[model samples]
Target chain A: MREVFQQSLREVQERLVKIAELVEDAIENATSAFGNSDVAIAEKVIDDVEEIEALAAELDLHAIDILARQQPVASDLRLVVGALRMSASLERMADLAQHIAQLARYRYPESAIPKGLTKTFVRMAALDVEMAAKLVELLRTQELDVVAEIRDLDDDLDELHAKVFEKVLSDKLANNPTGVVDATLASRYHERFGDHAVSVAKQMQFFLSGSLD
Target chain B: MREVFQQSLREVQERLVKIAELVEDAIENATSAFGNSDVAIAEKVIDDVEEIEALAAELDLHAIDILARQQPVASDLRLVVGALRMSASLERMADLAQHIAQLARYRYPESAIPKGLTKTFVRMAALDVEMAAKLVELLRTQELDVVAEIRDLDDDLDELHAKVFEKVLSDKLANNPTGVVDATLASRYHERFGDHAVSVAKQMQFFLSGSLD
Candidate 1:
């Protein structure tokens, strides 16, 4: 029974990593699409979102099934619960990325964001992608240190967000009022990107402490 | 052992409701703070986020105990897993609200978003407040139907968002760029509010179905 449960738990974890990869891809695609004003990339992200959502729903079911069938205890229970919680957050991360894609599709051809802030935007996007990837690492290895590490990376994202505000908000708004809306929204998205990083951090904390206890 | 486990599970449920209430208030506080450009109100929200995170951690511990002590299967397992998933999502929702608040605080006083869009902004705020409140109802009652009701209410929010967008984006962007930005972010918050509602709906689905299976 324990072996069956462990196998099921491992399968859930592996599936979660796969889903995380899709989420990472979606955010990167959405970022590139927005920065380049590429509607095609945005549309592709939109098309893939349903599959992501379905995968998330399916994963949650499997976790719940493991918990129900195996009636796991302590660390085992923590593992399944953590997987379920992480999947929900990751699903939202995908939704947020597709949301960014929707914004890109909405603003295409005549880009609302100023061209000058592309560098900052790309940097923010890279941070979001890396956070998603590293979160998967943290989950797979269960290196409790990664809980704190995710927060440190989140702080870096916060710094990036602050840079966008100080460097781009004032600079870009003064030059072009129309672009200011997109600039601010893009900044908001980047900041939100940081919060998702924090979300993963919190999940890792629960996983670590729950298992340890 | 079953009785003792249920006691902690009950405490978890009660605490979950408390956190839900906190998230509800945070959404309202952040929305109006953004609308009024009140940094102090937004600051209060930022301060309270840690409390939300802590509550979530405590809830996880309680649920994990229930799982370990009871070795719950079938219906009990479903309820605990669902509670676990919902609490995690609720925590993220609170964090997101704080993210919005931080955005408000960071850009305060001099947002320059056109003052004319206050009505639209307020409408969005109310929608967020409504959705959060409804989600609380759905969770506490264990009513999938209530979750569906929240989903139905989102239709109204969607219409309002669409109408606001059509007016805000299509018209002369040069005249009220700030208003557009403010309204846009407000709408984003509202949309996220709806997304969280969907999350509650999904959790209810799992909770309701897990028992039946």
Candidate 2:
């Protein structure tokens, strides 16, 4: 029974890693789509989100089933509960990616990065993609150091988010209301993608340390 | 043991209701502050978020303890799991409220609602507050009808969200870039607040119906 429970826990971990990988792909494609205004890649990210959501729902059901049958205690139980949360965060990450992709699709013939903020947005997208990759790594390896790295990446993303706002408000894009709206929404999406990655990292931290702090 | 589990479940329900009540208060105060640009009320909403966060954490701990101690299966298990998800949604709602309040506070002595978008924003804020209240009622009573009502409210809120974008892109606020940024973010925050409320309602539906659909 103990071995079976351990196996179920392993299954949970594998599913989380799988979802995280898909999320990484989604964000990568999303950023590429946003930066280059590639509607095909954007559409792919948008279409693939359902797969992530379905997988997340399936993982959640599996975790619940484990709790029902095995009744894992202490850290084992935390792992299962944390799996549920990680799945939610991963699912949210996919949603944000889709949102980013939609922005690209919305501005198909035009760029979403506005006039003066293209470089800033490019850096922000890179940061989000990097954070998604680190999240996948953390879920697979359980390395606590990766958690801090993810947080630091989020800090940088937040700064870029602020910078996007600053640029939007500056005279550089003063007359382009459409650019202002797109940049505002796009930057917000990129920043939130990083935030959800940090959320997944924090869940991993809780499981590793058995404390949310 | 069954009776003890029942007691624990009741405790979970009560805790969720408590948190929902606080969330209701947060959004109410937040919208008021946002509509009025009242820094004092915004400050209150900001300070109160930590309490909601702490309560949510405590409730999660309690739900996990119940699972550990009683090993509830089937519907009872669903209830506990649903509580965890609902707590997360409610906490997110509180954060969104805080975001709205921050928008108001940031634009102090100046209206966060741009010149022509004020009426639309007022309607959006009203819808959010109504949804929060309905969520509280749903948590307290478990009436499924409230779910449909919340969904309808979200639909209205989403329309207003699009309307805000339309107005932002129009020539109405052509020269006010600050107003454009603030309206964009504030509208997004309000829309997201409604989305989180719908999430909570869906969780309740899952608990009662044994399916997420």
Candidate 3:
């Protein structure tokens, strides 16, 4: 029974890594789509989100099945519960990526990065992609250090989020109301993407350290 | 054993309803604060969010404890899992309320509702507060009717969300970049708050119907 529980745990971990990898791809494609006005890639990200959501739902069912059958106790039980949460976070990250891609799709041939804040957005998108990659790594390895790295990346993402606002509200873009709206939503999507990444990291932290603090 | 497990389920239900009531209050206070630029109420909402977070964590721990001790299966098990998801949604609703309140505080002495959009925001806030109230009732009664009501409210909220953007981008607010930024964020916050409420409703639906569909 113990060995069977351990095997189920491994399956949960593998599934989590699978979802994280898809989220990484989604964010990467979505950000690239946003940066270059790549409508095809944006559409691809948009379409792929449904698959991620389906997979997340499948993973959740699997987790619940494990709980009902194996009835894992102590740390084993926590591991299963944590998988449920990580799956939810990863699913949210995928949704945010879709939101970013939608921003690009909405703008069509027109660039979504606005006029003067291209660099800031590029940096923000990079941080998001980098964080998604690190999330994949963390879920695969459970390395505690990766948690700190994800948090630091989130700090950078937040600063860029604030910078996006600063530039949007400044006089330079005063006449560009559409730009202001697009930048606000896009920046928010990116920042939220980073936040969901951090949430996954924190769940991993709880699994590793046995406390969320 | 059966009685103890049933009692534990009751405990879970009570706790969820308790948390929902708190969430309803938070959104109510938050929207009021946003409308009136009442920094005091905004601060109150902000400060109370931590309590909601703490309660959510506590509820999560209690659900896990029940899982470990009772080893419930099937519907009973799903009930506990649903409780966990509901707690998460409620906690998120609290955070959105805090974000709305923070917007109010940030624009203290100045209404966060951009001129001409006051009625729209007020309507949106009303829907959020109403959804939250229905959430509390849904948790307390498990009445599936409330679920449909919540979805309808979310639809209205989404329309208002789009309307906010339309007005913000219109020529009337062309010069008010700050107003655009605030309206965008505040509208998003309120919309998300309604979304979370709908999420909780879905979880309850899952509990009652044995499927999330």
**Runs in model 1 lying further than 4 Å from the true structure:** A111-113, A139-152, A174-178, A205-213, B28-49, B96-113, B140-144, B170-179, B209-213
Pick by DockQ: which candidate is best? 3
> Clash number for model 2?
0
Would candidate 2 be rated incorrect, acceptable, medium or high by CAPRI criteria?
A: high
> Model 3 over residues B1-213: C-alpha lDDT tens digits?
889889999999999999999998999999999999899999999999999999999999999999888888877888899998889889999999999999999889999888999999889989998999899899889898889999999999999999998899899888888899999999999888988888889989988888777
Which one wins by TM-score: 1 or 2?
2
Model 2, B68: alpha-carbon shift in Å?
1.1
Residue A84, candidate 3: how far off, in angstroms? 0.8
For candidate 1, write residues A1-213 as lDDT tens digits: 677777897898788878878887888888888878899999999988778889988988898777666777656666677777777777778877887787778777876457677777788788888887777787678687776766776787788776655654443455355466567677787677667666766766766784332
Write one digit per residue (lDDT tens) for candidate 2, span B26-56. 9999999999989999999999999999999
- Two-chain DockQ for model 1: 0.42
lDDT of 3 by residue, A1-213 (tens): 878888889999999999999999999999999999999999999999999999999999999999888888866787899898889889999999999999999999999888989999899989999999999999899899999999999999999899998888889888788899999999999999999999999999998888886
Q: In model 2, which regions exceed 4 Å deviation?
A: none
Predicted candidate 2 versus true structure: per-residue lDDT over A35-70, tens digit per residue: 999999999999899999999999999999998999
Per-residue lDDT of B202 in model 2 = 93
Evaluate candidate 2 by giving its C-alpha RMSD to the native, one decimal.
1.0
Superposed by TM-score, candidate 3 places the C-alpha of residue A102 at a distance from the truth, in angstroms, of 0.4
